[model samples]
Target: MIKHIGVVGAGQMGAGIALVAVQSGFETSIFEPSKQAQEKTKAYFQKKLPPHQPLFVTQLDALSNCDLLIEAIPEQEALKIKLFQELDSIAKPEAILASNTSSISITKLAAATKNPERVMGMHFMNPVPVMKLVELIRGLQTSDKTYHAVKATAEKMDKTTTTSKDIPGFIANRILMPMINEAFHALQEGLASAEDIDTTLKLGANHPMGPLTLADFIGLDTCVAILEIMDKKPCALLQQYVNAGWLGKKTGRGVFSYV
Candidate 1:
């Protein structure tokens, strides 16, 4: 029943989700305040999914009619809460509001909305078009009806679904982030060269990409943010890299140089 989908934030994740939603035959709209980001998304769609694109809107009110609104903003809790509060007042009473947060608490986000039952988490993997998994999280007050509707919507978009409780880091990041952290720890200890470490994991452990490379792909800053939210001890090396503003591929440098 989610015929109209709206996406907030025109970053890689948001634009990717909007692409999938529209390709799946849903009426999709994307709301982004930044014209630069909007242009980037437009260019991305033209290259990756020509002939189909979501409506780009500058105002939040344009999403008021969306049957489902997915927030894919940065990984900041305060920013997300503030956006949800505003969305709660603008969206239709029955519309569902979902967050694409990787490690934040769905229940806490739901609390910002007036109708908690319609607030849930729909954590789509990065590069939404390629990733098959979509983690569906039920907030403390999220209703079964809302969960099912969102699950169906995910299926319509051809994504496999997994359910998670309202936990910090949820399932994916709870396990993944720690492993990435250990990768940094190993690097700091001089246990192996970054290349050898990545090679060992790729050939030995059979991981698609080495942990350090994956961290870069996910954004080192984002990795740190998720770890901080999970209350994990800081890894000095990771902090130093983040401090240098080498936020992985986006910034052209991270644990390794992308330039």
Candidate 2:
């Protein structure tokens, strides 16, 4: 039933999700307030997407017709709540609202909107076009109807879906982030070099990428943010990297320099 999809925030995740939606034949629109981000997204789609382009809008009103609107904004709770409130007012009454938050509370986010039952978390992994898993989270008031509809839509986009109860970090990050943190601890302790640590995991544990590399790909700032949300203190080395603004591949630096 989700014939039209709208995404807020034209960042990497937003652009990737918008590309997937349009590639799967949904009429997609992306809303980004910043002209720089809009231009970046347009350039990305020009190279990756086919001739047709998803509507890129500078206003929230353009999302009025979207059957489902996925918010891929930053991980700030206040910002998300404000956007949800605005979306609830601007989008169609029947539109399903979803957040791509990795650590924030779905229940709290849903509370911002009058129609809490229609709000849920659709936490798509980074590099959305390639990531196979989409963690679907149900808020306290999220309806079964909303859950199933979003699950079906995710399947239509060729993604594997897993339902997770509304909890801090949910299933994926709850387990993954801790391990990545431990890896940082090991490195900080001088137990092994970053290369050896990652190589050990890649060859010894069969992980496709080492924890440090994965941390870079996920963005060290994001890892730190999620750790903070879970009430888990990030390792000192991780905090140091974040403080240095070496956020990861996006910034050309992180655990290891991309340049």
**Which candidate number would show the highest lDDT if scored against the true structure?**
2
Backbone clashes in model 2, listed as residue pairs? none
Q: Can you write out model 2's per-residue Cα lDDT over 1-259, one digit (the tens) per residue? A: 8999999998878999999999989999999998988998999999995547899887898899999999998888899999999999998988999999999999999999999999999999989999999999999999999999999999999999998999999999999999999999999999999999999999999999999999999889889989999999999999999899999997999988889
RMSD of each candidate relative to the true structure: 1.1, 1.1
Clashes, model 2: 0
The C-alpha stretches of model 2 lying farther than 4 A from their native spots are none
Indicate the residue-level lDDT of 38 in model 1.
Answer: 90
What does candidate 1's lDDT look like per residue over 1-259, in tens digits? 7899999997878988999998899999999888888988998888886456689988999899999999999999999999999999999999999999998888998998879999999999988999999999999999999999999999999999999998889999999999999999999999999888898999999999999999998898889999999999758999999999998987889978888
Candidate 1 backbone collisions, by pair: none
Ten-residue stretch with the least lDDT total in model 1 = 45-54
Clash statistics: count for each candidate: 0, 0
